[model samples]
Target: MIDIKMLIELFVFAGDYNWIGKERAIKMAESTIQYSNPVIPGFHPDPSVCRVGSDFYLVTSSFEYFPGVPIFHSRDLVHWKQIGHCLTRQSQLDLEGCRSSMGIYAPTIRFHNGRFYMITTNVKMFRNFYVWAENPEGPWSDPIWPDWPSVDPSLFFDEDGRVYITGTGGFFGDEPKGIYQAEIDLESGKLLSERRLIWQGTGGKSAEGPHLYRVNGKYFLMIAEGGTEYGHMATIARSDSPYGPFESNPDNPILTHRSTGSSIQATGHADLVQLEDGSWWAVFLGIRPVSVPFSGRHHHLGRETFLAPVTWTEDGWPVIGDGGKIAEKMDASTLPLAVDESAVSETDDFNSNRLQLEWNFLRNPQDEDWSLEERPGYLTLHGSALTLNDIGSPAFVGRRQQHFRCSVSTLMSFDPLHEGEEAGLTVYMNERFHYEIALTCGVEGRRQVIFRRRIGSLWKMELVEDFEGSDIILGLDAEPFQYSFFYSLPNGERKAFGSGECSLVSTEVAGGFTGVFFGLYATGNGKSAKTPASFDWFQYIKS
Candidate 1:
């Protein structure tokens, strides 16, 4: 349950800390810390973190899900609270072609010049954009610029106060590509001059998601390459100039899963931050092999975010992962846990003013079209045409599949006797791998449940029809690589709808290199696809 009382109390403390001297406030926040040295699962991939005095704000990519960019605040960088969503308006995102795995990519968060800025890449449309706000709790500016061959963009304001942008090229036809840089005008949301490709990637044509940092007297450029798959890695280079002929580290790929070969396949995309005590820590994305010992079957968890401490060697290069795989268990000598343990919330009542921070939209979201408070006590979803595949329609909403054993249920009703109306739950990824249990309203009034997994552009689909489609309960049961569907009939009896063995593959499996997501969607197919449908409530229960 959410601790409303504690949250209210924290507000009072936050205000008091501002009035206190910097040293005094830092001491006060540090003194109350109970949990120190948070271990594994500290955070997820594509992490964006910023420190404001003693408080820190962190966010992660949501990709095609609305309530995009989940925000969290923490005093010790271990315990966190979901504050709000950064991209709440529809104009800020375009999701038409955004497969479940596409949409938002790696994001970089920075605080500068009395404002907070977030820069991210959208791979589906291949554009790099930025959002900013005077306050972190924001009515943030909509994204600026729409199309570019940019992926994984980071912003750096030099000592002279000139802002520069760096990113990896999106096109595959590479001409010895490396990290590139250009002067950028924040006000106009435009690149002022031509971009310079700084360094050819250390490896083959896989370099992307570059983040630039200036520390000591040298400029460090960090990047992820070898694709986001078994060969994923983190490498770095350094130069005296921001636009540089950066020299790759003698021990390049300072962090990687490559040493474990195809077995522990890990992809590393990292963001670096300095702790309040001046220690350097890096938060990056990585994944372990599903079936250990290098089996090619049934992978469990997908790519996830991780934190590794960094130490600067006498030679000025950065060392990560402590000379082994990211240490899963670390001694809690630095930051202790305030509570014994904490986990991300996995349940929803549909009664809050907003969807839980875990909920996201298919692409960018349109606020006027959907409401969690419309029912006042349940989630209300409005219909949109953007089907799962339409980049123009906004017909999708989703949450991450954080557990292998979990059940998703939804309460839904369609406009009675209206033809071509369908609404229900879905485990979606791209146009291909997805399953849905739908309530269809028409003269026939059909309550049909279906399952579909993509093999390419084509879908393998199975449908079972019997129950009347008027306001029914639908459920999807998933365990590992298998799935079973269930629904309650109007007669108040339960029945097995259908079942299928599936490979939980997404755009990543299809070679697009993106994460998978499962959520709820309402569609009119393609014709009259705008017909409105609503979901009373959607819930995820971990059994």
Candidate 2:
């Protein structure tokens, strides 16, 4: 068998003829980004972006995860720096009984007046609201508006200083749903007019994630339709007015993956930005399910962020997504530099602002419950009732694992588990697909290293050792979508156990529309047990 590291090296660098060409082009592009480049990867859904001078700020939905909107900054709309999370306050959301699939939906980020605003839906609570900040890093204000029956809310400001919010709520009778826009008073947070239903959708059904943009005297509304399933798509409509008797783009369903092959399912929820050069590009979410006919298990590499160039017609409407079908490979070389060298850092020294981009909570974050400075050297995670189901739980932090061939390793030591205490690292994909290495106290007052995995209907378990140790390395090696867990002792011997060679199942295969994530967690099972866990650090390498 070929060595995994060698195979990756060969795949990435084997061909030499285009190295200089690739490097020269790539270098030119990196020059534009002041911070990091290719800022994020894989399943950063419902992206919202706003440009303020030379800097660009972006946000994405947290859905059953806390830290509701993740805020990122960029200079060239390329390399993004994760600045902070927008809704860190508790009063902003309630995730009780929030299933793994519920919570915040598509969010819209906008800059208006003197502040920055983000609007989104809390699906479980059935409300649409907005959060704003004077500065991007934010002491963002709490939800100023709440409990409206809408999801995917986008805010629009017209020329005369009128403010409007656009979103998708429940269906209008049986016709799926249409974009709804209502006049809003920015200062008092009041809706001045009833919601006006506009842009029924493309010829297909299920319209959502509406973004309103004004270009060359016309108001354009871009949205995704055809459900977020196999036929996911992005379409456009335009009107002389923001409220719209809008006209659909003749080239409706502007972007898609269906034509290439059903296997490359491209569902688009897009945001557009015009460059300093006046060139246009759209940052949207797309899917490329790995499984052929859709299985009940794994869909490893779907639901990822994709960028495409856009050309405006003489009529001023924008076209996107390979124009019609996603390209197998495009001359990304032609694109001018958007970021300065892909400067993203996957390694964490634990000394930055909170956790690196790697860490994510299960649901909305409990800000007071966590601190990077309290422990100084270690991350302190307080326990919350948010087991695995509540998207608003307080005891979970995770990061995206993008490369198929990579290794994730972390160091953890706990306060010692009593009866109900559990803390560990995990490779999680929904509730159904997860593998964990935990430190739990045994019945005899000793601790044990327990490994567990959910294999179909049963949870398979194994014991590496009977709690004889404290400091240890929990590592996961992933090749393609399959993962294997290992324990590297302080002395450096690797032991494989629990959920051996398990395939990661995502919404694309597991029947949802989300992506895969690996996380660290601590749980208290009703019994009185002190939370005994301090994580040293987490490391990921593309082997």
At residue 464, give the lDDT of candidate 2.
45
Looking at model 2, residue 347 earns an lDDT score of 64
TM-score of each: 0.79, 0.84
Q: What would the per-residue lDDT of candidate 2 be over residues 67-115, giving only the tens digit for each residue?
A: 6677888765555667888887668877666776678888888888779
The runs of at least 3 residues in candidate 2 whose Cα sits more than 4 Å from the true structure, single-residue gaps closed, are 1-39, 146-148, 172-176, 262-264, 292-298, 327-344, 351-353, 364-375, 380-394, 415-420, 443-446, 455-457, 462-467, 498-504
lDDT of 1 by residue, 1-543 (tens): 223335435655665777655555545544443322222231246676787777677777766666567666766566666777677776776665566567777778888988888888766777789899877778888887723467778888788888888887636675446677888988876777787889767874478878888889799998887877667788889999988878898887877767564333464777787877887767677654454233354333455666667888899889875652464443333542344223555556677786666676655566655777666765655665445545554566777666557787776665534555566776655565566666665346554555444545666656646444456777778776666887885446766776654355532344443344566777665544444555666667676
User: Cα lDDT of all candidates, in order?
Assistant: 0.65, 0.69
Model 1, residue 517: C-alpha shift (Å): 2.9
RMSD (Å) of each candidate, 1 decimal: 7.4, 6.3
Candidate 1: stretches off by over 4 Å = 1-44, 96-102, 123-125, 144-149, 170-176, 185-194, 259-264, 292-302, 336-347, 364-376, 381-394, 415-420, 441-463, 489-494, 502-511, 529-534
Native RMSD of candidate 1 (Å): 7.4
lDDT score, residue 181, model 1?
82
